[model samples]
Target chain A: MMAFIHHFTKTYLMWNEGPMIWTSDVLILLTSIGILAALTYFKKWKWLWTEWLTTVDHKKIGIMYLIAALLMMFRGGTDAELLRTQLIQPGMKLLTAEHYDQIFTTHGTIMILFMAMPFIFALFNIAVPLQIGARDVAYPYLNAISLWLFFFAAMLFNISFVFGGSPDAGWVSYPPLSELGFDPGVGENYYLLALQITGIGSIATGINFIVTILKMRAPGMTLMRMPLFTWATLSASIIIIFAFPALTVALALLLLDRTIGTHFFTIAHGGDPMMFINLFWIWGHPEVYIVILPSFGVFSEVVATFAKKRIFGYTSMVVSLMLIVIISFFVWGHHFFTMGTGANVNAFFAFATMLIAIPTGVKVFNWLFTMYRGRIRLALPMLWTIAFVPTFAIGGATGVMLAVAPADYQYHNSYFLIAHFHQVLIGGTVFGLIAGMYYWWPKMFGFKLDERLGRWAFWFFNIGFYICFMPQYALGLMGMQRRMFTYPANMGWNTLNLISTIGAYLMGIGFLFIVLQIAYSIRYGERDLTGDPWDGRTLEWSLPSPAPHYNFAVIPTVESRDAWWEMKKQNRTDEWKVKEDEIEPILMPKSSGRPFMFGVAFFVFGFGMVFHWFIIALVGILVVFGILAHRAFEYDDEYVIPVDEIKHVEVGLGRL
Target chain B: MTTQTNHTGEAVHVKHSAKQYIIGYILSLVLTAIAFVLALGHAMSFKPLIIILMILAAFQILVQLFFFMHINESDGPPYHAIGLGLALLFAFAFALMSIWIMSFGYHAQLVS
Candidate 1:
């Protein structure tokens, strides 16, 4: 028992670091305590538990995802600022090398996995069903499970900072360096296990979304007639299902190498580290598309809706998206052309990498032509979409530059690559999601976000983005490699670094205004009484704002490509009208605390595995299985909303 | 209270019999047996042997999918089967590429 206690305290509690308590650590603790106190004081625990923690409703789940993504963005943003501050001047003692490594690694991992992924999934949950005129996802219960699993995996990762040391072998966690001989700590263990768990959730989500989009779309909604956003979701989900398995295999092998003495990626045991790299990028390259493709979907919707144009070249847009997915897998070798994969092999990948630009260019032109002769709204979402075009174009241009096999030898691991990705990811995915949030805010919550404040946020973020990354491209050309904690004063790299840091701060301020905008809007924003807020083109806008619990009172029968637009043209508002006798009781999956409870169990299980406590880990796994068994034996998993109750809801919402 | 069956406006269900499952099982077993025997007995040259084994494996998968899994049944929409087929294609491509890349890595190491 004493030995067990020793292991627990030593391996689990990072609070015992030293006499000096860091300010950030104290802030994290205080913020958590303050949140709990607020919840307790307001007596909202039950409300939170019933409405949020156990929600199977896609809208509520989407809200939870959005909140979590925003919180992760804050954490990742802080890490970014810290990295920037450390690089503000040469010979700065702001952070030690080890701390810098941990910060940057966490920053990258959290930004991509927690922030970008959840943000995308949040949109998926909120919009996909609505766009396709479905009542809910194909598996609402499993949807809750996916969200909670993501939450717990994220918690497992975040707790490493306050409980144990954070993973420092970069987000990629390349082995040999990540192996036990070098790391020998609980950090890489946390990285592998957290990713392994979350990755399963992601795979589940992938399958769930695929089935939902394919099987749950409304009557008369043929494949070609689905909205662009739905099309994008389908393409992205396909990529996720295929690509994520490689990540699962890679992370699992790395875990075994770290824990049970396997050598799948170790240098000495006849294992090649190159294989790990190969597997990582096999997932990693498509993963770039996985995150970005959904954003592409978001942009297509935003551009068409705002431009008041039937999306030009709709089929071509879909073809390009499919083309991107196909070509994404073949270009993983471009990431490692410098490793002497032979000229022929490198040439094939280099050309394949460049081939991506053709389809992407087609998409770009499609969006442009969409706005050519149409009345453009210049709404907040449209502004972000407009900003995305040029910024992502530059990113694509630089991407092609780096794809050159010979040029990559010079540019690889430099700030140029950094600039390129942040340009595409931040400029493309971030902008697109932010636009989606703005566009759909009225639909999700019956109110418009403050456009005045939104404009401020957009300018600051866009300007700050360019200011942050553009100089990095120049700095890379001036021979500044990435991940360096500090440098000699003679390096002449201080000015560009300072400008980049300042721009990062501006972007931080921009994010702050968005927070303020949400808070301010909650109190005083304009209410969207009419369901059709943006004069939107899709089925989502046809429902009342804050759409009724069962999204469509009647599951809408969609007939054209732009189903709602066509309905409006035919003056068909009565399509939503339901005859009194036609009303059937609606059956919905009953919400239960099982998914959240399972999350807690998995967290405990993952925490135990991280500390190598075999019995505790086994117990956690058993608990998870036990809960699954309990759920399985239960037949009454759903409840019917009576016709009278549906009528009551409709009357209350003025939708009858 | 009347027992009201909820109608989601999905297509009518297509039920299958136990005989279909039995046939699928038999077909899968036969294909596996052929591939196993050929590998053990050296029934063909290496290249042709691999090709035949792959063909047999493909047939086995189709039999299982169509017969047992009911890929043809449109539970609501027929696109579920299409999605699965596409997923399988991508998976096959990924596996092939990983092998090709890894083999090339090995070859490069040998030459150097």
Candidate 2:
């Protein structure tokens, strides 16, 4: 008992790490305390628990996802600034090499997995069901479960920094180096388990959205008539369904190798580590498209709305979206072109990788044609969309350049490669998400964000992005590798490195401005009295701003592509208003605390696994199964909002 | 109430008897047993054995899809069929490509 306790204290507690960890611990403790105290003082605990935590309403769930995603973005952006600061000057002792490794690893993992994934999901939850004219997602309870799983998994991954250690195996967590032989810490264990838990949520989300889209559209909203964003969500969900299992297998096998002393990806005992790389990239490549495709959808919506035109080449846009999805699967080999899978394999992948650019180019032109000869509003969403064109074009061009397998030998693992991906991911995905957020913010909160502040934030982030990443291409050509903690002054890399650091700080400042914008807008921004802000085209815009729970008292029958726009054009805006006799009781899934408890159980299980505490882990697993059994046997999961209540709400919204 | 009509007002509920489920369950178990016996007993050469196992697996998937998943019971278009077909295609591609890529590593002696 004493020996076990000693081992646990020495390894898991990690009380004597350093000042950085101690500072993080203190900050976490104080911040948590402050939140709890504030909630208590404000007497808002029940409200928080009932409305925010337990509610299965998709809009409230979406808002929670948005809040969580923005926080994760802040965390990830801080990691990026720290990395740039460490690399700013030669021989700078700001961060140790180990710390640098951990930061970069966490930065990549957190930004992609926690930040971008949830942000897209936020858009999905907020927009897809509304646009399709559904009261809620097909499985509202399952949707809540997905959110809680993601939340708990993110917490599990985040707390690793101060508790034990952060993963240092890069975001991919490739084996051999990631194997227990080399990395014996619990950091990789946290990475594996946390990702596995979150991956369950992601897969559930994929299945949920697929069913919701395919099965729950309003009458007359045919497949081709669906909004571009809904189509994008469908495509992304398909990719998630196909791609995440590979990740699950990869992470699971790696976890087994770590915990149970398997040889799946280890060096000895006939284990093949290269297989791990293959599996990782198979999912990794499609994972990029999964994120960017939604942004593509967002840009399509924003451009059409701001330009006051129907989207150009709608058929081709959809064809290109699916083509991108299909081609994304075949091009995983491009990530490891220099690893020498032979000439034939490399050539095939290079061709496939370059082929993706054609469809992507088609999309770019489609967006351009959407705006061509049309009135452009230059709203905050439109501004971001405008900036994305040139930036993503450059990123895509460089991507094709890197696809040439022979040329990749030179650019492999260099800053140039880093520059290319960041350009696409940030300029494409992040920019698109921000545009969508701006476009939907009024619908979400019933108040528009300050346009002036949004533009300020936009310019700072956009210009800073170019300044930060464009120079890195030159640095890559100059033979500066990524993940390098420091280099000597004589390499001619100092100037560009310092410039990149400055640009990164600018982005940090831009993020702060966004925080300021949101805060200032809450009290001062324009209220969306007319739901059709921006004269929007989709069905969501036809509903009230911040649509009441049980979203549409009577779901509109979609008639044409851009159903709401067609309604507006025909002067049928008041069609949704109904008489008291027309009102019907609405069925909604009842709120339950089971999903929250499930997440807590998952967190405990993950935590126990990370520390190798079998008893705690066993207890957690038992409770998880207990919850599942309870949910399965319990059939009274829904309730009806009576006709009177529906009428009252409609009258309150002045629609009756 | 558990099988309420959707927004499209289609009868989404597909009735199945316990007899059908029993048949499916027995068939699945038998197929699994055959695969297990073939593998354990070395009933054939390696290539032919793998082929037979693959065929069995395919049959198993069909059983699961038709009997369990109710793929043919939809009132609308055969979206379930299309989705299942796509899923099978992707799964096959994933397995085949993994083998193709990893075989090169084996030839290069990188696996050792």
Candidate 3:
């Protein structure tokens, strides 16, 4: 009986011997309880479940993604602050080495996978269909499944912190170190299965967006006439479809090696770790572009609308986008030049890497020319766009410097490399997403984000970004390495480290201000009566702010590059207008609890596998398949919105 | 709720006869048999055997894509063709790059 109790407690509860609970765990517990209590008190469970948990509406799904990404950002940000605080003084023993490893690993994984990917997906959901004048994505039910899969995967990864151990082999999870021989924890198992689930969802998203963009565009909207955002979506989805398969294969092989004693990546059995690196970068490098391309598309839209002119070199912009896509795959080899490939191979990759700058340079000058001799508004989104140019240029220039194979030998794994990537990622992707959020805020909700607070956040964030990373470049030159938890006091790295830590705090404050701004605006901000709040040049602005579930009453036919702008110029809103008798019932997919139930089942399966409980895991798998079969055989999956209901809703909103 | 519309009476889809499917299946089986016999008999040297097997595999793929998958039946949508072409291009690139880089590096290591 004692032995049974010990085994049950150790395996099921994951009760480590000493100090098993942390402040973060307690905080998570309390926050969850508080949320539950509030929901019960307000009697909002039914509203929450029916409206959000089972929603198939693209906009609602996007908002759910936005909320999840923000919560993850806060979690990842706390990890960053902890790192900064520990590094403030030399030889600080605030955290143990083991804990430090887990912190950085989770930080990298959360920031990139959980935060940025979902943030971009949120924008894609809210904006893509609207921009192209489609009523919904091609596969709305599949879209819900994708969101729930990603959500469950993220939850599975996060609970690793409280339930067992966190993965310490870094976000890349390179082999030999991550293998069971060196690190034999269930942490890496969680990483593998969780990523497999999310990766499958990501692949589905790629296919969904690709089919939608290609097939569902309104009449006369030719490929060239498509909005830049849609073009970027198409390009990025292509990359996702092609690149994610490499990740799927790599992860599957690693899973097999760990679980079933395969030699796919095991070094003792004649496996090569470099092969893993190759496969990883094949997916990883393209992933970097996948995150950045949609932001580039956002920048294009913002630059044109704010500048009050046609984008300067539209053909060149499209060409540059495609060129980036083609060139991205050829340059993945540059990531490992220090691994000692032959000079001929290194030279080829280096040249290919540097060639990316040429197309990027064309885009920079095009943005500048668009703003030249044009009426440029200094709106909040435009402010971010204006700041993005110089910062990203510096980032791009440093990128070329590191692309040199010989020079990269010195900068490899140094703070300089860290600084270079953060510059591009934070400067390029983060800034552009913020710009898009602020620009589209009025459309997503009925009110605008408070501009005064937004500018404060903007300046603090931009300035804080520079102050934080610019010195890391110098620190790298001063022989500082990354992933170092502490340093000796007399190494002359104290002052700069302190300054960087200070900058990190300022950025934290900037994020906090944005959060407060959101809360304040939701209650007291002025509402947008006219949907075209910004005098925008896209199809989304043609609808009312906080657009209806069915986006357009009548499907629009495009006639020019900037379709909405052209319609406004010719006063042709009447052209596509439907008479009262022309209104017909619209078919929409019915929302079901299947996706939410699938997520719950996945969590159970993942948790069971983490504990090596094969019986529970098998049961979970069978339940999942049963759900899929149930959905397949049930053909009554859609319902019609009657014409009278549509008329009543539109007339009430004065949109008729 | 509105009554369901019956579109079954409206249009006729093209129907291929059973003979066509049977012929395709028989041809596929014969090609597989020839490839297997050649491999088992050792009728050619290694290099020629590889080339002949590759050609047979290509023929099988074409037959499946045309007959079973109905690639040509997708009418007026050039995007499908373009997407297929792009996918094939990337598949070849992935395979060739993997082989070339690994073999070249392995050979260099051996020489060293």
Candidate 4:
């Protein structure tokens, strides 16, 4: 009764006051408190705050990132369900336009920013070091710090629903619309602080992966010889390092505009709104590739593995990804074709956008060849990869259509555009992430997700996703604009809308079973101590289940493609011995709470700015720096693995 | 960070001293001033001025990559990756700005 009342009150608070979260806030707040209390009740706080939050171990940090992503996925998915419900009947006013605006806004924001980005980051953190046969990333402390910063940012974004309003502006949070005078609510401020806080994490993550992939590869694994996933990870990191700083500056300027009344992006005080668009899209353009490139890399691995072939076009796939990264930066202006820049500008952006499809099309062909005729396993992960090509193609085709400037005018700001992006984005990036979870679950925790339930998830999610979104494309083509409250009933739209809503609810049920599937597996999943449970091709599967603190028994020499699988076939797991004599005490950085504390302080300052608490914000800034400075000088806290212990642990054999 | 197998173990030593790094910083300042002066004259003719500044920027980029970033030749594959990264940045610069400046008048209005 008490929990129900608490949920009810939270929901009431959410609907009555949480601005952008107008309707979603209630459930999210209760869930947040529930999460906190549950962790405390289970005495998991110490484990979470210590072993997870402050740990410099790449694997732990990766798990934390995924957990954060999972929680936000629920939040975002609920918002999706709500929006679908609103469209169930054309004339229904179940959710007001104000509520609807916040609903879709939060849905997009939470999905793309909060969910997809972290999921990619989590994969990078977990896989990169292990695949290279390294114990940890080049800068493990920085890796932990980055995850903490992201978590802090995510927490702040959610907490805003309780303390104040959420941003109701679109995910892009365009200028003029986002200007303080125009949006007197606290919502955009929520958007600003949350993203800026997370932006720090994103930048740090970029640097961490760059250093890890660049600095920490095992011997003989040359750049060309490195896995394609590593290449894609490195490319994506570089994009983040350069791209996110642009967003950071833009958000900071917006923060200044909102609180200190600066002129960075103002129409009133000699500020140019177009500059904001440029800044936002500069970040926004690269962001598309940032999310998808890693997934592209993942799909390549997935297709090759399931087909029992060497990746068919490795060189071309890498080249295509590299080209896609470059082209991604150039296409930001397409988002603003409606801003009336010029015909020449539109045509140029349009042309640039169309050219990208060529490389992307090449990637599709590569995956197709990988699956052409080899012994195909319809594993859940493979099923996703198989389904993704056709789905993302449809999405990509619609993207090219949107690129046509004259046609975009009709589609711009309509549900049609929304449908298009959600298709490519969800189908392309999000599905890849889901597939990744299934593919790598064994490697991450030494247990596979139950295939029976897993298959159920795959089919339900895949079919339900298309059912939910395909109709939206039709609805969009029917001249329905996005972000509206209610539509007239007799417009032939109700049936499709009803079917789409049913699809969403079914997806929700499908997702629930998936979660149960994971929980059940964690409790009773079949354990394979020998890591190559899937006959894995990568170095990661060579390691033991629940990999050791020092990943490799001894850092091994990587001499070929499919390094581990080759080593396994050659019976050379013992070859790590040749280098074991040279092994000295291995040093790993100690876990420190300073980074998490700094993240908290940054959040405090961010909140202070949101509420116009000048002194509090100032203190918050100081606290952040104070934590950073304290971190810079400490050199003595690392743990060392003695040579004797190394030998005891079969130093002759490398795990992967 | 260059990934490397250091059998010699002390493979990443650089000949440049701290004083050389300081000198590099000073040289950067002088180069920046020269670029700025060359740029001011060509403000109205941005094409030439931007060309000059970009050349200067390239010099700065190389200086940082070689001196500051220390893409350690003895270490790993990072040097080539960094070079490729720079090349990609140039591609983005050309691709993005060209789209901005060259295409300015055809079907810019999307609110039909």
What is chain B's TM-score across the candidates, in the order shown? 0.77, 0.79, 0.76, 0.57
Full ranking by lDDT? 2, 1, 3, 4
Q: For candidate 3, write residues A1-656 as lDDT tens digits.
A: 99998885565345653453446566778999999999999999999999999998888988888899888998898888888888887999777778788888888888888888888888889888898877788788788888998899999999888767788888889998888898788888888888888887789888889877876776678889988888888888989998999999988888888877788888789987777877888888888889898888888999999999999999999999999988887788888888776776778889999998898899889989999987999988899999999999999998999999999999988889889998888888888888888888888898999988988899888888888888889988888888899999998999989888888888899899899889999998779988888888888988888988877766777889988888888999667555577677877778889988887777778777766777888887888898899998978888888999888877866767
Question: What would the per-residue lDDT of candidate 4 be over residues A198-273, giving only the tens digit for each residue?
Answer: 8888888988788777767777787777887888899898889878877887888987888888987886777877
> Which 10 consecutive positions of candidate 2 chain A have the poorest summed lDDT?
A8-17
Ranking by DockQ: 2, 1, 4, 3
Which stretches of candidate 3 lie above 4 Å from their native place?
A1-20, A574-578, B1-60, B104-112
Best of the candidates, TM-score: 2
TM-score of structure candidate 4 = 0.88
lDDT of 1 at A321: 92
Interface RMSD of each: 5.3, 2.9, 6.4, 4.6
Listed per candidate, the RMSD to the true structure in angstroms reads 3.3, 2.2, 3.4, 5.0
Scored against the true structure, residue A65 in model 3 reaches a CA lDDT of 87
The parts of candidate 4 lying over 4 Å away from their true place are A1-45, A571-584, A647-656, B1-112
Against the true structure, candidate 1 reaches a TM-score of 0.93
**lDDT, candidate 1, A1-656, per-residue tens:** 99888886565664455432255577778999999999999999999999999988989999899999999999999999989989988989888898899999999999999999999999999999899888888888888898999999999999888677899999998877888989988899899888888888888888889878777777788889988888898888888988999999999888888889999988798998888888899899999999999899999999999999999999999899989978887888888888776777789899999999999999999999999998999989999999999999999999999999998999899999999999999998999989989989999999999999999999999899988998899989988998999988887888999899989989998999999999999989999998888998899989899998788777777789988888888999686666566677888778989999988889889989998988989999999999999988978888888999998888888766
In candidate 2, stretches whose alpha carbon ends up further than 4 angstroms from where it belongs are A1-10, B1-7, B105-112
All candidates: TM-score? 0.93, 0.97, 0.93, 0.88
Relative to the unseen true structure, what is the Cα RMSD of model 2? 2.2
Candidate 1 residue pairs in clash (backbone atoms < 3 Å): none
Candidates 3 and 4, the one with greater lDDT: 3
DockQ of each: 0.27, 0.43, 0.23, 0.24
